[model samples]
Target: MSGLSIPIHPITHNPTEAWEQIKPTQRVIKLNVKTPTTPQNENMLRFVCMSDTHCLTSHLQFEIPDGDVFVHAGDFTRCGSAIEIEEFNSWIGSLPHKHKVVIAGNHELSFDPKFTCGPAARQQHKNAHTGGGLINEIPDLGIERAKLKAAVEAENTVNLITNATYLQDEPLTICGIKLYGTPWQPEFCNWAFNLPRGKQCLDKWDAIPAETDVLITHTPPVGHGDLCCTGVRAGCVELLSTVQSRVKPKYHVFGHIHEGYGVTSDGKIIFINASTCNINYVPVNPPIVFDVPIPPGFSK
Candidate 1:
């Protein structure tokens, strides 16, 4: 990703009017520091974050820096095959970070039974019933689906990634920081963690714990880092509302739409779309790194 300097919201005498002019569309600048470094007397937790690797770890051009924690927001595999999952797990195991947090992306079909067995089977049944009609219109995997199902059952049922804590709609605290990870996004191309817009999606987001300090999701909140190359904004509006109004996580990290790889902030929340791949699916985008100070008087 380009090290493009974003426009920061300047502090003004008129606080109310200044905030009103700071729209989510306005890009908030990222720290220009290449590596996370601690200043005097600050207990900063350095995080090395990358997402949407899509099984392209071998092609990565840059080195992942050492940090207190490593976060893979999602899309560790191109397809959610058991072999791919194991490979990603092995790679995660090799990383030097002490705490590694991973969340599933929309592509991780086996992680969600609703997509693989429940809805997929039901849709297949419906297609057969309706003289070859299609739901979601994603191509039938046929034998591939059968193979993937078996692989998921055998390898991914109990322990998918041995080295990292994989979370789905769950919160985990590491070194005094309360973090929540969720894979759900607004329905798009019918992938995993997809819920319909409005109530369905909003209800899922409503599950976010109010005290979350770090929010890891696979999709960018609307109007933040979700602008597609084609000019269409593919983000969850409801997610943005939830993040801004209620959850208000200090840092929100995600990746799915590869084109939307960068950092932005809306005063309170720093949104990082750390998509590791480019639009062409090359794992060339650099891992975004940053530091968040451990909250005062907090214990692990």
Candidate 2:
């Protein structure tokens, strides 16, 4: 399925089988969407956030839960491949939510992320060194993480998803609340969507607006819900700084770290890491649900 592509129906009243086929065995969370006729009377709009589903279509049978909008941070597919994307899109479209926001993670390499034409893959290592891509040297023992990450993504083993096909990256208003999303993850040993620290990842974080009412990110900020297998926080320090300083959205939802499938808050901002899969890729974390107040400035 190198160039796999599947068509997806928009969010609608699709049959249960539509989602069942994609997901074979998994717990499902049934969510209820607000009625269109209902007024934005509630001070807060209900929001449900989930991520790292890894193509767990079986989970869909449980119902997506109720909320003003449905948000997917990233890693919606196992390999992020075209086939996986279509599977995800089709299932997502079946949901009857007012709006849906999504973004691509390093694993969700929707397009040809491999830098077959980039300088890194073709970079030369003289001094008795043979041909090696740009990932040859890094803190993770110079394992050429970038090239490996790309290879795995392109392989579509988990199905490649990417920034190109990502769900939503710009400021969006739903039920009178502002929302934004970013899919970049921290530097890992050659994983997809990994952004280097300092300016590399910070640049993308800078793109987020300060007044965003709801922020959807694929990965968590440093010290928030970002923990690795070693129990060390693998989140981007710069992202943590940027999000706290420059981008102070009311609610930030993400789910790259499955181990930390819980919610945290900064008194002002609500952080949710609804990882349906555990750190070991088990469907443990349930979908996170909460209601956000709607300021008078926003509209439906």
Which of the numbered candidates is closest to the native, going by highest TM-score? 1
Candidate 2 per-residue C-alpha lDDT over 105-221 given as tens digits, one digit per residue, 9 for 90 to 100: 655543324432244434522211543534344333333444434443344332322322244457777766877777776565455567555566666777777777777888786
Every model's Cα RMSD, please? 8.1, 14.3
Q: Give the winner by lDDT.
A: 1
Point out the worst 10-residue segment of candidate 1 by lDDT. Answer: 1-10
State each model's CA lDDT, in order. 0.74, 0.60
Candidate 1 segments exceeding 4 Å error: 1-33, 37-42, 117-158, 297-300
What lDDT score goes with residue 67 in model 2?
66
How big is the positional error of residue 139 in model 2, measured in Å on the Cα after superposition?
A: 15
> Taking the candidates one at a time, how many backbone clashes does each contain?
0, 41
